[model samples]
Target: MASTAGIITPEWELPAGVQARLTTRAGGISQAPYDGFNLATHVGDNRTSVLANRRSLLRQLVGVRSVQWLTQVHSNWVVQAYGGAVVPVADAATTEQRGLACAVLTADCLPVLFCRDDGRQVAAAHAGWRGLADGILLHTLQQFPDPKRVLVYLAPCIGPSAFEVGPEVKAAFGWASGDCFIAGAGDRWLGNLQRLAAEQLLASGVRSISANTDCTVMNSERYFSYRRDGDSGRQASLIWIES
Candidate 1:
């Protein structure tokens, strides 16, 4: 993987043919608020700017032919990506085809990438608290032939210190969540998205797990956080197999 500015390549021990990268809020022409490198078109960023930024991102992806973008709805739905302009309405996508990138957009929500040990299959998921509680990661893992051989990468997201949730949110995960939640003001709880995701993946038999804990809410200069900035732009986490 080439180390490019404003892009993060996972440091996990992935197979030879797998490629992955996560974009930060940098190196784009978007104006203030949306600022730079906003990849999501659903947000209020100008359509032209969003497209320009996406094209710029595509150029950086060396061997990638096309990226599968999704219209995320915070559900557990996972689809087989075929690399086209048609945006599927799903939170996660998987692909066995080379050069077809599977991608998910997020601001503060956790973005998880998956690839088999042999680098034959890859997937990406957008996991918010609701999606996690609803089993988004598990659903994505199901797309693979064997969960045990899949390598998982947890990208930057809202950290425990910054993600305050209500009582219902904590109740959703029940006792399996363990110390992933800490007592907060009133009936709120400070939740750790990455920890919750890791626990879920481990429980599902996935052993190779790596994470980037750079909290999006805390790193205003490098990330976009919806919880921090209401109308903020989104970054993308993508994975693919080389052609």
Candidate 2:
């Protein structure tokens, strides 16, 4: 496990046969801004350094599968991956193939992972406001066998208190969003991306779920927050099978 400013590092755990980790600001090769431990190569982090950091991340986990990286345009698109598929571009990745790490990168946006309690399949999705509003989690849920049989684990992200949005962004959810948004000063609204994700999960039929309460924006010493600092590095929320 890596450490960022040492605030958050590999914080949560999935059930048996399922393995998961959320990276903080530590243990990487990138410079400041995209500082040490940044797993996102696309966020202006140098190519070689990002690759090296990713390699280092893999080295830390013995027997873990290579992470399936995504292009992540914030669309509702999701991809299905084989056990050997590595670094495919898509907002979400699902697998019946064991040992392949279904992963998503985030700096305030939501990264959600799901799997059947049986561990025969798994998935990860990148859901920023756009994707979340467009039903990305619901799309991922469609890939599951039984919604209630699937378990959801939310990785670290910008909390509602720190994630203020414009009315247009707030209107994206309409009434379906409900209390996911709270009043912010002026015309702004505080959106809880994590809670919105949970609502979507339940709507999609997922009954079991757990969320990481750490707010990336508020806890700057730990996870990265793109909202707080423009052009920031990204923390990875990843999951893979043990068998």
Q: Write candidate 2's Cα lDDT for 120-176 as tens digits.
A: 888999999999998889998999879989988887888888888899988888755
**Model 2 spans > 4 angstroms off:** 1-15, 83-86
Model 2: residue 13 alpha-carbon error in angstroms: 6.5
Error of 2 at 213 (Å): 1.2
What is the C-alpha local distance difference test score of candidate 1? 0.91
Residue pairs with clashing backbones, model 2: 3-26, 4-25, 4-26, 28-37
Q: State the lDDT of candidate 1 residue by residue for 142-216, as single tens digits.
A: 988899999999998999999998989999998555689999989989999999999989999998899988899
- For all predicted structures, in order, the TM-scores are 0.97, 0.91
Candidate 1 segments whose C-alpha is farther than 4 A from its true place: 1-3
Task: Give the CA lDDT, 0 to 100, for residue 85 in model 1.
Answer: 74
* Clash count for each candidate, listed in order shown: 0, 4
How accurate locally is residue 156 in candidate 2, as Cα lDDT from 0 to 100?
Answer: 81
In candidate 1, list every pair of residues with a backbone clash.
Answer: none
